[model samples]
Target: MPVRRFYKLYLSPSRKYVKTLKNLLGFVPGNLSLYRLAFRHKSVAQSVKKGVKNSNERLEFLGDAVLGSVVAEVLFKLYPYKDEGFLTELRSKIVNRANLNQLARKLGFEKLIEYDNRMISATRQGSLLGDAFEALVGAVYLDKGYDFTKNFLINHIIKSHIDIHTLEQTETNFKSKLIEWCQRHGKDIIFEHIPNQEGESTKLFTIVVNVDGEVMGLGKEFSKKHAEKLAAEKACEALGI
Candidate 1:
């Protein structure tokens, strides 16, 4: 090991954390603070500034983007003859909240994450696990680089844990499921197309799902229908449907 990494593993105050990460992630993190921050839930976070808190939300956002890009590339190469729609659906299945939640649990995120137990129940902690997983991805991207992050994701996470062929056979119509649940509950659910931000691409469609006038979920995609489906998938996860 290099001198810096050797110090972090053997002599640093965060040696225990570093060792744990190595066991969990298959590599030692250079920036111990980023990985630590990644596992911190906002419920226990203290505000570092007026409105900013030392939480994993920002890292989650960055990791979401990075994860998407890597997944897209992998799917593209894996299914060269597949159409855009087919690829998109498969990608969504792989990166869905419910799926990521399961993956995180399998990887033992429950032991590493920091949260307020009083505020979040064990059943409701899956989302927190998913968020932490993404935040960890962001930390890896920032600590290493795109190539390293991609390779790590493909080799350590995807190839080891995920079953792509099984996912392809699984049909999860979250949109239909959400609609049926809403009808059964007598809740007014609406899928609305919203205007994009100034810098956002014109070709991209943003769909927001609202239930009883409350925003349930939001999704962005090149196809409006796909965006609505994505939003409904999120809504379904939020409602535990």
Candidate 2:
């Protein structure tokens, strides 16, 4: 494709995205093509050249690294007295899969991703939106620079979206906390999955958390891990730990 014609074709239709990007990032994008590529999920990726993959996966990887570096720096500066372990834990909470997915949804990123039409289910879309968010970070880094990317993350994402205080108080992994409590109190903990007769299509797992031979909590969720986590949360509330 000729450069001028390609620019006209892509730029014309992408005016709305350009405006949206400007509003979101607080800067006009120098390369709109990079942003467009960032929004293209692997499921709908096209081959731009022979034996080459044109998808957001590579960008996602880069973005993940960049995000980690920025977050680490922010945490280090924000909590100067804190130990390395604390900073690492805080960074994990901030960049976890569930948190990123929620952030992407809250920022209206789901509407911007170009994914496979067949995979339009809610769970799939949520995952894609999170990946696209990472890819967008990569695109910002490429279009702007490291310093600009860091500033954008600090000003737009960290200060705007994240509540550090609330995160400090939040228990991201209830199950892990409960396990630690159990270990400290010298109690044996076990999670048992109750079989569901609701057939394969609608099967839901019911998890029972037992501490020292006593059932502490029971919970049901679509996945066993989630069910166990919910049960652990209930157990925590019941035990007041």
Candidate 3:
């Protein structure tokens, strides 16, 4: 087939891809071309043209930055009294890959990705779905504006889906809580790591958590701090401290 004919054929499918994405997003993705580009796997692009750039990497970049900004804005308004560190940690928790993956799955984004074969499996595992979700947010921002994106996030992602209280209680930071408990009780806590003479892929470490020279807990893990925290958590459970 002639090169020009092949190029024309390729363009034809692109239009259909755009139509699909518009329906998927429940809005016509502006610069629908960008959304199409977002699903194009790098391998597929390479096969088609050596210099051809596809893949959602660029959109992911723009989306990542845009997501960060939007999250920051939301957090600021939600927790006006929160210190920067608290807000930062909360934002990190809210926008982490796992959280985004959950949202993507809920939105059925995995089916929208364009891949050859290998990328499809990995994409189905939620990485690409999450990336495309972020890219969709970026596209929405560019298409509509910040307010629309903000409302979309709050209405669709935050309010409708996320359970704030459950998230807070389940994944509570044990280390921070332990430290705070000790401080409140006027107790000095020390974490001591038993020496590991040999290193291994999963090396065992002994942890002894002492409160005012009394051994409160002991535990073991593949790492020192992890063992210590586990030991401390056990102590917290036992001592109710």
Please report the candidate that would top TM-score against the real structure. 1
**Reference-based lDDT, residue 66, model 2:** 97
- Tens digit of per-residue lDDT, candidate 1, span 121-149: 76577789889999999999999999999
**True-vs-predicted CA distance for residue 166, candidate 1, Å:** 0.7
Candidate 2 structure quality by residue, lDDT tens digits, 52-157: 5788988999999999999999999999999999999899889876678889888888778888878576435667777888898999999899999999999988
User: How many clashes show up in model 1?
Assistant: 0
Best by lDDT: 1
Number of clashing pairs per prediction, in order:
0, 0, 0
TM-score of each: 0.76, 0.67, 0.60
Candidate 2: pairs in clash: none
Clashing pairs in 1: none
Q: What is the C-alpha lDDT profile of model 3 across 51-97, one tens digit per residue?
A: 54767776777888888998888778887888998778778777776
Question: Candidate 2 vs candidate 3: which has greater TM-score?
Answer: 2
